[model samples]
Target: MKKQQSQWTHREKSFSAFVTGPLLSFWRQRQERQFVGKEGVVIRYMRMTAAAHKKAILVVPGRSESYIKYPEVVWDLFNCGYDVFVIDHRGQGLSGRLLDDSQLGHVAQFSDYVDDLETLCELELSGSRYHQTFVLAHSMGGAIATLLSQRHPSLFTATALVAPMFGIVLPMPEWVVERILNWTATRPHLREGFAFGTGRWHATPFGINNLTHSRVRYQRNLRFYADQPELQLGGPTTHWVREAIFTGRYIESIAPELHHPVLLLQASEDQVVDNQAQDRFSLARNLAGFPCYGDHPQVMEGARHEILFEKDEIRAEALQKITEYFLTFNPNTV
Candidate 1:
């Protein structure tokens, strides 16, 4: 706790030497569990527990992501001496798919994610005693996690949001996109169909992919989907987009009302979510005399949407910040 975890460098090792070998091995050792989510959906999640641990960290992954994509993250946090929990949100990961087409990502309501998460915590952690509990969420999960914190004022001690999906980076203005989505969201077929230019899951080439600059990490992620097609997740449905947009606005509207502290890390080169919305959330909270951790959204320059899985340097920085922040709430950190 006195010193920060060092940022990993690309010079460290090759793919098989690290990711496929140790990371994969560690990932398989996690306890796999499931519970019935809203509407009979089977929600799955993973947990790494320590007998004498006094702290716990729950990881909330982004849209189109699974706990399978987070072994490295779980390993890192677990080594930091805290229990780690990662959930596969409904409609993605090993969880039950809402739509008939398993690839298409859709949710009945954004709040359902929050509901499932709360239920999971109640079923799993309610009986445990962890002095400091923290939430590390990314993208859409960030929105979900925030809403969870809002509903239960004392569930978590603090939260870390990495490139949260406060708003989607649309081609046109917000009002125009809103009008279009709203008109179609109520329709039966169109509402559940793929939104705009998106479609079923496909492997985006490394060169053209905007997710991460780290070829190693990106390729490893692709390896997961290629090996197990069940893990592949595609674009969001029209209803999903509608829910996300409206929920993002509501999150900003209630930014000042969050009871627990939050650390919002924004990616400078992120092309998925609108940074301006993050700014608005941070500003709103600060103006209300309740600022986010570090007083504003922390911007990680040259980073893409997936900071936790970005290049070594960027990912390391994010991990260090997250580790330090969670440790700050630990009475024995020193």
Candidate 2:
């Protein structure tokens, strides 16, 4: 497929002040709507108006994330002259919860996520005016995006995965944890307990939290959850853990088959996802004895798992690199 004209530009930094300001009023002006996902679950999504001649970028958030948590990122893309679309995945955010306890994170199958994403794209994005589409996914959403990009090779022009959860760091060995969760996931009685007895419904204080090193951004998230308790989600259920393990392994296995232009961003000091697995996935250059395209891997030294929510300097650096990479390939030109 031939590429189209380049619409990328050196947009100035205009979202510098959004992190500390009130975002509800700003986001209320963005278009919001709802759609029925798998099993008729209601999914909430929003879209930002794009400047003329710009493309669309979809934001796929990680576990326990909500669209409410990404106002700064949305504004950043807006400043970069790209229209942004964001969604609250089914198990978290404003979407319908899976279990009786709304705070418990659970999913019967990981494929449900992939199906929901495909549905969302077909219904919401396929008929849009713009032909070039870009994707920026984080953590668990990165895993989902990896599978989506591979399964539907023509869907996106380019993709950037930040702190992707191709493999996760657990206390026990990966196989051991997977076996335990697999056992628990099948039994109806063991599905309600928190995975590893962590990730409660309430927000952890910033003094002891490891999500981000930036106090300002960390406290801002805490305040968001405090004002909107319904958006607060707790630990994952055994089923959720089991599903994630299987999904991560699957994504790793298919990493070499993906055909899209990819930039895999790694957080050098991350304690969440397995960085070794990320390295292996990024290095895959062969499939079925045939040479394949390898991903462009970049490491952000000293950054934590939440690169977008990190310190001002680190976040700025990551976004700058991401913008530069995406500008190299115009979907219309490809």
Candidate 3:
């Protein structure tokens, strides 16, 4: 899709000054639910439905993210005429942890995340045939969504990914990283420990943060962790990192077979996931005649890794594109 003056001008008016009182009210409206995931772990998720029930959007968040940080996003999509659902993966958010230390982000296998999501769809979204369902995934959740879509192609109408983590922007070369991961494999003592340059959950100062430029949104999100310290998540484990790399390559290999259409939104100034990987995925989809991220390079100029929680101007543009893209699947409805 080309950037243009979308009909969703009202969305651009400004929800940046997101108030706590109203956000809290919106949070209260959601139905807190949980289900048994892979290995008998209890995974949590939230559901916020609009009265019309015309359409639905699944909000798949990035690493260290929780539903509590999505009041604004859920509010926007619901107002735009769709119900919203958000899942907390096995090792993060409100879900159960694999390791004893709640701060360590460890998982037995990445497929467990994909399996838990598929189970949720089979259960709570049992009547999903009544309306079209779309996915809004970001960062690590992006990989999980990709796996889910490939496994169940007919489950969702379409998918929109924001800053999807197709690959990680590592601190060192891939060869070196692979060697390090291999070394960890031989040492059980280091396998479950935090990766280099990461540790217990702590707030990064907004001025030097690489996630987003919106200080207000940044500070507001920090408060959520402060108010509920249990929601705080630290770095990833060596096992998790190994799984992520394996899953990412697998997704790229299978991109050409993805049945549903995808709209990927990239952050130009991202210091997180590899942009080149996103491009490769888009190219792979296009090879199979699927419409992927249009006119690459700078999808969102000067934006950081957090596109959904970006400044008003950047976030508004992203929301507009997503609204238009999802509607393309059923143009005559809503």
Candidate 4:
């Protein structure tokens, strides 16, 4: 069979509305599938195929992101001779929502995301023609990927974490934040406010947004949510904040045991996750004379939290580095 080709390129001078538009006629559209996650929650996913490629890239998106937001990314990978798989985690995107208010972001525990991802892999990826698998995770998804790596050491050949959430950069002190989270999580009916005073189901104007430097890319994403209100979600809940804190600490404990080659891509101007935490994890071996576990850290200067949504020059470089990292480890790469 011949490989499917895409007309998309990362070298575009600006994000093309034609490419990122709702129609998506030029790109191969992914058929949505559902899997039963832990406790019978339904998780939604989409897989894009490259008929002749034997390698696959599994993309795990961050909070409030759905597979629809990543058509350009999927097209880019498919054109580079790899299959692409992306999913909307439970309680976000098209997946099942936890709270009665679908717009409210909520998760009782972070491990539920891990369970959902494992189910997707078993149902879709096991024993497939794509022999080697790589992961490209962003933000919170990066945390999920790291936890998966610690638990299943041999699952992925290599991984790239873009602006991984090792630690969240909150305004208050860590102790005070933890205290508030603990109290709110334990409270039965007193916790419904959005974290950091962000309102429910609200959109920020491009001028005040800190997500990405590219107005074109930012507007494109906003358009997606505007068209499909169901896919849009707001700030994290108290339970979610508590669970994430626990998961972050767990990852730190097992960081020394992770043997997989990981590329930790840190954004220099990231206002979401703590850059100092990423630095500590990346340089743990050098600083403490501990055994190295292939933690390679690369910084994207002047980029914000969402490096993938930044200006074309920055996005291009980041994608190139990610593609190179995966290709280097996949023996089938030509």
Candidate 5:
């Protein structure tokens, strides 16, 4: 547990030196602004460790996520001697919001995420003093990273996915529901507007409760949200869900094209995304005609979708596998 030397000003509290302590202090330390893309979308990002390091990792968060949500993970990477860069994707956190006139939280395609990623890699990595670069993506970010790795095979040294939302374990039949929604949306676009899930403005204890393996971590996350109410990005819009289904299906169709060495971290008890699909995809890739694209699959038992936010020991083990794999198979280093 490394003590954070800088006092955080956001929530009027000092952060604990331990890796899994309160998040307000960490969030306060990372409230700086950085520009991304030609439009200067003002993506909020935080960098850990100023000393030039040999390797760097760009962390992408899940849907409707803010950079403040993952300070512990960033700190872990920093302590491991890797310079870390984390950004809030467009329409989330402090990045550019969808136009007021348009549907709130609407992202028409995942390719938009790819564009953002490409800009960050070109602008940040190209100018950085680090020697090697990799991507660690979670959930929706995992899908984006997979697609990006395939499209720009030479850009990243490797990619690590934590509970990648390749597909979801929906309570309802996914294909049937998706087809029905898509069909309904075709006739009257304006009439098709519906909020995703229960469109509640406040964070649900149930949602945050199920996120971590330890009560301490869950409580810490809750306290941060208590201070910064704006950090709570409720549910996805109907349009956003529709877009996600479309993007997810499209990405699934293109998995065979990915050429980078990928490390897929699947949680045994993941509730949000389909664990079975993750395992299936990994095994299918190994059996698929393209042997180069799939080989490394690491499963962390007794973990949830938020694997990095789990108890300290579990999180450490998961990260160790990632670090080891990247260090071993990184194309840029080898």
Candidate 6:
């Protein structure tokens, strides 16, 4: 099928060029709307299509994220000859907020996200006429995708995880600290807040400076932040951290049950999730005779937490590798 290039304004072009290199060879306009779930929660998504494409890739964003934060990724997937659908996780982006008061953005459990994804897949993507459907998730979204793959293996053809938050790289005493914090957060007087090392609430110009390979790419992301101040999200609360710990443990225990083909992309220099834990999980899955654990697992050197938002060349290469893997596994569809 032939692909068409979507028009972009000068500002948008500058933004895309700064983040994606010279010019985007394959770009498409996106349509945004809400995918209603059970219990009246609306999951917001942005979808882009290629002409005559029969396969679709559903992208799940991480914590404090919105669909607009992933323009580069959406464009790349469109170029790769597949329809791309990006969903804003519940309590983030344009989705339903968790807390009504000051804690509106905070989540009490990671399983809540898993439930949202399950509903999104079954109710949203199940009836679509695409020949093949897959999921591509990053960080926290990666964790949810892993859980979803285990819980609903038949819904997706495969999954690609970028810097998935399977576990944390904390000091030995950190576990004790987390337990104490969790207990304390339940107190009547103590208000819940984020844990240590999470990013600040204010969007700083320097936030992506150190993590990205290109200054222009970082600047472009900064511009997006400047334009959309409301999309900024704070760190996880104490309850969120506690729930994440439990979720990580649960996923680890059930890793053997996942039968869907999985591609795990680990950043060698990731400061967020524990890369060692991801490696160990992959190794254990191989040793335990898991069918889909041996799929291509690559650790990109000098990459940070946000692989999709990295420098133009680096991000493009990473996306290429992902698209290649997807096409190789399911060539009959794409």
- Which candidate leads in TM-score? 1
Model 3 ranges off by over 4 Å: 1-17, 293-298
Ranking by lDDT: 1, 3, 4, 2, 6, 5
Which of 3 and 4 is the better model by TM-score?
3
- Counting clashing residue pairs in each candidate, in order, gives 0, 7, 0, 0, 1, 0
Candidate 3 lDDT over residue span 8-89, tens digit each: 3333334343364565677788998999887779899999986677688889998889888988888778877788899988
Model 6, 115-169: lDDT tens digits are 7778666644777677788789998888889887777778788888888888865
lDDT of each: 0.88, 0.77, 0.83, 0.78, 0.68, 0.70
Ranking by TM-score: 1, 3, 4, 2, 6, 5
Expressed as tens digits, the lDDT of each residue in 1-334 for candidate 4 is: 0132212233345347556463387354677888878777789999888578788889999988999898878877777777889989989998988888887788878988988888777776778677788889999999998888777878888888999987887778989988887777656554654675655776789998878888888888899899999998988876777777777777776676677778878888899888887776776634544433344468888799999878777777788778777767753564
What tens-digit string does per-residue lDDT give for candidate 1 at 69-126? Answer: 8888898888888889999999999999998999889999998999999998897777
Clash pairs, candidate 3, are none
Model 6: what TM-score? 0.85
Give lDDT for model 4.
Answer: 0.78
Per-prediction TM-score: 0.96, 0.89, 0.93, 0.91, 0.82, 0.85
Clashes in model 4: which pairs?
none
Which structure among the candidates has the greatest lDDT?
A: 1
lDDT of 2 by residue, 3-64 (tens): 11111121113223443344555676788878898898888888887558357888999999
How many pairs of residues in model 2 come into backbone collision?
7
